[model samples]
Target: MIGSLFSRRRPPPMTLPDPAIVVPGITATYLRDDYPLPPEVIWRVLPFQKHFGSACLHPDDLRYEAREPALIRPGPLYEVAYKELIDELRYDLSPSPEAEVPVYPFAYDWRKPLDMIEADLDAFIDEVIERTVLTRHYYKDGYDCRRTVTLIGHSMGGLIIAGFLQATGGLRTRRRRTCPDHRVSKVISLASPFRGSFEAVVKMTTGTADLGLGASSSREREAARLTPALYHLLPSFDEGLEVPAPLPRTLFDPQVWQPSILRSIETFVARTSPITRTVRKRTEALFAGLLDQARTHRERLDAFRLDQAGLGPRDWLAVVGCGADTRTRLTIAALEDGPSFVLTSDDRRNTWPNGTDTGDGTVPFLGAEPSFLDRANLVCVTPDDYGYWELEDKALTRFGGGFHGILPNMNMLHRLIVRFVTGAPDPHQKTWGRPAPGVRPDAWDPPIPGLRNKAL
Candidate 1:
C-alpha cells in the first residue's frame, strides 16, 4: 500500500500544456470614415491606408479562428460644441474628440452624446457578444473567460479603452451584454495617439486647406489656432486682408500681391518662429515622460479594487509601439477644394519632421504611453522581446527589419499572439533572458538600435 501511494502523482512542469492559445474569438475595432470614398469599395475597404494595410498583414498569423470588426465614429461637431458654449470643459471633457475635429474618426450613430468613451466601449462589447459565443476550454475546466476574448485597437482605439475604463464603472464591470462568463481578457494598442501631439496641435492651428474639414468645427480649434506652432499655416484662410480697389467699390481682387500681403507673410513668419521652438522643446520632454510612465504604470494599477472584474495578478496585459524614421514625406493625394490631410507613419518617433529627434510620424512616445488618469495596468514591450517578428534568416534579425505589421504578417506575430493570449509557454521568451553587462542604451556596435530590443 505504501509503495503504490506515491506513484507518479503529477506530470512534469515542462509537459503541462498552456491554455491561452486554445481560446477563440477576437475583435479589432476601426474608426473614422466620414470622408467620401468610391461607393464600390465603401464597406469593402477603409480610407486610411495604415488601417487597411495592418489588417491585411495579419492574414497568415492571427490565432483565433474568427475575427470581427467594430467601427465607431466620433461625435458630431455641433453636439461637442455645446460644452464650449457653457465652458464646462473639465479634465474629462477637455480631452474630448471635438477639440480636434479634423483628425477625429467618423461615427455611425450620432443621436446620443459621445462624451464618455466608456459608453462607446459598451457598444463595442455589445458587438463582440453579438458576434461570439461563450464556451468552456474543456469539460473539467472551470468556466472562466481568461483567454476567450481580446480587444485590439490602434490610435483612438487606445483613447476609447481609457475612456471605457475610467468612465462611470471600470472596463471589467461595464458590461452591456454580460455572458455570465465571457468578458474582455486582453487589450493591445499599437502606435496609438494617447497624449496630445505637437504635430496634431500644429496642424490644427494652421488654417490651411490642408487641414481636414472634420476639425473645422472642433472645440479646440480656436485654442489650437492661437498656438504658435500652427499660426504659420493660417494665412491660407485670409480673405480680403489687402484691398487695393480704391476704398471698397463693391469688391477688390484680393489675389493681387499688395504691400499688406507682404507684411502679413512677414509678420506670420516672425510670430511663428518662437512657437516652432516651443513645440520642439515640449515634444522632446513629452517623449521622455512617456518612457518613464511606461516603467511605472504597473505600480499605480495595484491600487484599484477590481477583484470582481475577474482580473488578477496572473492575468496578462501588454502594450506595443513601433519606431521608425520620423521625417517621412507628407502630402494630400487628391481632394476637391478642402485641405489635404497628412499621410505618414502613425508612430511619434517616425512622424517628427526632419531634424527632430524622434517620433512614429504622427504619435510620440509620451503621448503613446497611457495617460496619468489611466488606472495603469499596461505592460510596455519593445517589438523584439514581445516576439513580434522573426526573420527567415538569422542574419537579418533586426529590430526595425521587423517593422510595424511585419510581426503579425510573417506568422511570427500570429504565433506570439496565440502563445501569450492563450496561456501557452512562449518559445521566444527564453531568448530574451535579460540585458548583458555594459550594454549601453545608445551603444553603436554591429546591430542597430531598432533591432536591439529583440536581441535582448
Candidate 2:
C-alpha cells in the first residue's frame, strides 16, 4: 500500500518534444542604439510610443556588408507580442513544469531583408541543434548528432523559415546557400504570408504599420520606404488585386507605385542623406532599389519547389487565421499622377477591410497558403478556433484586424503546435478547422497521417 502510494505520487511522464526555435514577426524585436555610452533603447515596446526617427535605416543599410545607421542593433523579442506564446511553449511542451524544454526565441532586426534574416536563422538553427544535443537525453547515448529541431515562425518569421528550408532543400535559387542544419524536420508557421499581404502596402503608404507599437509619424513613413522587409511583403497573389495595375500588373514594377510613394522617399532623402544628385533622381533610385531587391527575393521564393526530392510540402504546418475582416484585396487605379491605391475604405478607415472570412486581418488566405498546397492540404483556423475554457486567452488576444499579430497566442494554435512537434495524436479537434475553397468537409484529413495536422 505504501509502495502504491509512492508510485501514485510520481506519475509516468510523457516524452519531451523536439527542441524548438520561435522566430517573431517584424517590429517584434527591440532595436537599441549602442553608439552612445548608455546605449539608448530606441525601438522597444513602451519606449517606441514616442516615435524614434533615428531607427530609420539609410538605403546603404540594405547593402550586404553594411553596419547600422548609427550603431543601432536588434535586441530581445517584444514581450506582449511573444511572451505568452513563449511561456506556454516552454512549460506545456515539457513533461513537467520542472523539466526544461528548449524553446529558443530568435530575435532579428525586422527592418532588414528577409534573405539576411534567413541566413542568420541558418546559423541559429545550427547553434540550437548543438545546444539541444548537449542537454541530457534519456533515450540517447553520448550525443544525438542527428537530433532534429522544430521551427515555429510567426508572421514574417515564417517567411524566413520558408526561405531557409528552400535554401537547404533540393531546389536551389538566388539568396540560396548551404544550410548545414538538415535536422529541421518540422516547421510551424503562424499567420505567415507566403505570397504576401496588402497590409505591407498600407505600411508603405502610411508610416503607421501598427505591430503593437503605436508609433506613427512623418518619420515612421520615411522609415517604411527604406524598410526592405515591408517591400518583400508586398502582395503578389492572384486574388490580392481588386483593380489591377496599368501594364505589368505587379507591384515589382515601380510604375505601379503611387506618386506619393516616390515623393515620400524624396522628402526623406533630402532630409536625411547626402543627395549627391537631384532629389527626384535619388528618390527614384532608392524606390527602385527596394522593389528590385524585393522582386529578387520573391522570385527566389516562387522558384522554391516545395515538392523537391527530399523536401515535401507536408513537412511544414501552415496555420492561417480567417473570419476576420481583412484587406484581402486592393484597388490600384492608374492615373496621370501615377498609381493611387484604393485600399480598405476610400475614406481611409486606415485601410482595414470589412470583407468576408478571407483572411486574418493582415494575411489573405489565397496568399498565406503554400504555392504548392491546395484546399486538401492547407489547414485554415480562425480567431474563435479555441475551446470554451480558452475564452479568457481569446479575450486577451484582441481578434478583429490585429488577428495577424495576436494569432500565435491562440490556445488552439498552441495545442496544434505541440501536437505536431511532439508527434502527439490530434485528440478529435472540436474547434474552427475549415477546409479550403475546393476541399470537401469529409476530405480534410485522416486519410494521410503526415499531411493531416502536420503541415504549414
Candidate 3:
C-alpha cells in the first residue's frame, strides 16, 4: 500500500511535427495606421464645426497608424490564393486530432525594402523556434523533437527565403559553417524570378502594366515605385544579348521617359513660357530625386548579385512554369534623334522582333530558373492550358490563363507539392506529354506537360 502510494505515473512522450513556414509574396500583408487628435483641438467651436469636413486638410491633424504586419484572412481573393494551402497544410501537419498545423503564414510590410523584410523574417523565425517549439518542449523535456524548418515561398517570397538562407549561411558549403539551430531542412520555391523580370522594367518605365493584383490607387502606385524592392526586380541584363554600349538613354535617365511624362513636363514649360524660377526649381528637384534613386537601385543590385554567388543548392526544389505566352523584352535601344525607347524581342520564330515569348505570363521561363541552382534541382511543369478556359468562354478572361497567379490553386501542382514535401515518390519521375486541344485525359487531371529540356 505504501509503495503504491509513493509511485507516480509519467505522461506520454510528446512528438512534435516538423514546422513549415509559408512566406507569401508581395502585398500579402495589410497595413493600417492610426491618427489621434491633439488634446487642445476643439470640435464644438463655430469655425471648427463649419469646416468639419475640411479638418483632414491639415497634415498635423492626421495620425497615421504604425506599420504592422498581419495575415490576409477574410477577403475573397485571399480565400482563393492562400486559404486552400493553409487549410490543407493545417490538416496534414496537425499534431493532434483537434490541433492545427504549426505552419505559420508570415506577413510583412510589402512596401518596405527587402533588407528590412529580411531582418523581420529572421526575428520571426527565432520567435517561432523559441515560443512555439522550444518553450513547449523544454517544459516537458529538455530538447525539442523538431529542430529544422521547411521554407515554402512563392514569387518574391521565394527571393526573401533565398536572401535569408544566404544571410544565415543555410546553403551547404565547404568553407562556411552552417548554423545548427537555424538550419533549413528543405526549400520549395515556386515561380521565383531569381534572374529578375523585364516586365518590372516595363512597369517602371511606362507605369502601364498591372502586377496581377487588382487596380491600384495612385498613392499605392507611387509607393510601389518608391519601394526599393521594385528596383531589385529589374530585368537580368545578362539573360540574352547585351545592349549596345554608349547607349543614349536607359531607365536611369528621366529624360528618356515615355511620351506621357515628357508631354506633361513640356506642356507645363510651354504654359509658363520661360518656366518660372520656383516651378523650374521644383521640377529639377523632382527629377534629381528620381534619377538618384534609380542609380542607387542599380548599384545595390550589382552588389547583391556579387554577394549571392555562394548560394548553391543543398536541399532545394525550384518549380518553374512554362508553355503560356509571356511578354519578354530582349533589348532596348534609344532613338538616334531623341530619347525615345525601342524594345527588341527574342522569340522562337523571330518573325516579330518585338514579340513576347512563351512562359508563365508574369515570369519568363528563363528568369524562373535561378543561375545558382543545379540542373537536377529544377523541375519545369507546363500546364495543358493557362487554366482560363472557363472564364474565357464567359468573356471574363481579363488576366488571361497565365499560370503565374493560379499556381497555388492548380490541382496537379498541389499534388506535386504535397508529394515532394512528404518525401513520397519523386513527383517528376513520370514523363508528362501535353494533351491535345479539348481532349481531357484521366492520367493526371489537367495534365502537367513536362518541359522538353531543363537547360533554361
Candidate 4:
C-alpha cells in the first residue's frame, strides 16, 4: 500500500477493436440431424462428409417443421477453412485484459435459399449488437454500441452479406434504416462471386468442381443437385459463355442444363421416393424451382448499385485474388446426348485486365465483378502475397495460386481488417496488392490534417 504514494505517468486508456462477425462459405458450415435421438452429425463426420448425400435438402424435408425435435441444423465451422482466422481475431483484437472484443463466427444452414438466409442474418446482427452493448468496455469507453459492427464474408458468405444488406435496406435504402443499415459499420468481401461462378454449373451438371479443397463422389453429385445454394452460385455475368453461340447465356433455364442433371434427379427420386407419381414429374418440378429461385436472387443483386446504397470506399471493401489460371469462359454445346459444358483448360491464359492470370482460380475476374465495383476499386491479392513472417502458411500451401479456400488465413489481410475496424493505423503505412479507391472514413483519433490516405 505504501508503494502507491508516488504517482506514475498516466497509463494510456485500453484500446479495443470494433466487434466483427464472420460469415463462412457454403460447405464451410457443418450440418447435423437434430431430429434423431442422439443427433447425427451429417455433413462432417470425421472422414465421412458426404455433403448433401446423407442429408438431402429436398423441399419435402423443409415442409416437415412440425416434427418433434427439429430438422437439420448448422454446427461448428470447419477448422480447415476458418479456425486460424477466428483464433487470430480473438487473440489479437483483444488489446487489454479488460477488453472483451466479440468476434462471432456465424453458422447457418447453407441449404436454405439466399433470402431465407438473409432473414436469419438480420436476427443474428441484432443479437451481436445486443451482446456488444452488454460488454463492460463498451460502456466504460463510451463507444457507439448499436451501429459499430464490421462484417467479413468469404466465398458464398459474401453473397449472403450483400443479400442481407439489400433485404434490410442497408446498402440500397435511403429512407428507413433497418437492422443491418445502422448496425453494420462496414462490409469486407473476400473472393465473393457477386456475378456468380462457372464452377457452380460444373457442380450441378457433373457433381464435381475444382474448388481447390474438398473431395467429390457420385453421392456428393446427387447431393449437389439437391443443394439450393450451389444453384444460386450459377454464373450470371455476360460473356461467361465464350463458345456455344445460339445457346442463351441464361443458366436458370432447364433447357440449357446438361441432360445428366435430369437423369441424376430421376435416379435420386426413384431410390428415395415411394414411386407415387412418375419420377419425371417430380424431377422436372425440383429442377425448375432451383433454377427459378436462383434467377430471382441474381436479378435482385445485379440491379443493386453500391454508390446509391450509402456505402463508400471505406464502408465496402472488395478483396479479390489473382495470378491464377481460372475459368472465365465456358463452352456449353449441344452434344450427341444433350447440352453439356466444356470448362476452360488449366493451360489456357485468360484476358482479365488485372494481371496475367484470371481470378482466385475459383472466381474469375468477371465473376468477382458485381456491376458496382470498378476495376480500380477491387483489392486484389495473390498467392505470393503471404508475408515473410507467415512461412508456415506458405510451406503448408500445396497449390499457391488457387487460394480460393484459404484467403482469410492470409496475415496481410488480417492487419488490414484490424486497421479498418479499429480506426487505428498500422505502425507501418503500406498498401497491399492493389490500392482500393477512396479514402477511409475513420482515419485518426482526433482527425489528422494531411491524413488523406491513411484509411484505405
Q: Estimated TM-score per prediction? A: 0.39, 0.83, 0.63, 0.82
Residues forming the 10-long window of minimal summed lDDT in candidate 2: 171-180
Off by over 4 Å in 3: 1-17, 36-77, 95-99, 134-146, 170-181, 214-221, 240-244, 248-314, 336-338, 343-357, 385-401, 426-456
| lDDT tens digits, residue span 280-306, model 3 | 555444444545554554444334421
| Per-residue C-alpha lDDT of model 4 across residues 165-282, encoded as one tens digit per residue | 7666453222222123355667888889988888887776566675423555676777778877788998887665753656666888887878887888787777666555777887
- The parts of candidate 1 lying over 4 Å away from their true place are 1-117, 130-148, 168-182, 202-316, 327-357, 371-411, 428-455
Candidate 4 has what TM-score? 0.82
Residue 364 of model 3, lDDT score: 73
Best by TM-score: 2
Local distance difference test scores for all models: 0.30, 0.67, 0.48, 0.68
Worst 10-residue lDDT window for candidate 1 reads 20-29
The C-alpha local distance difference test score for the whole of candidate 1 amounts to: 0.30
Top lDDT: which candidate number? 4
Model 2 scores what on Cα lDDT? 0.67
Q: Each candidate: RMSD to true structure? A: 19.4, 7.8, 10.9, 7.6
- Per-residue lDDT over 213-252 for candidate 2, one digit per residue giving the tens place of the 0 to 100 score: 4535676677777888889888887655755533577888
Residue 209, model 2: Cα distance from true site in angstroms: 4.5
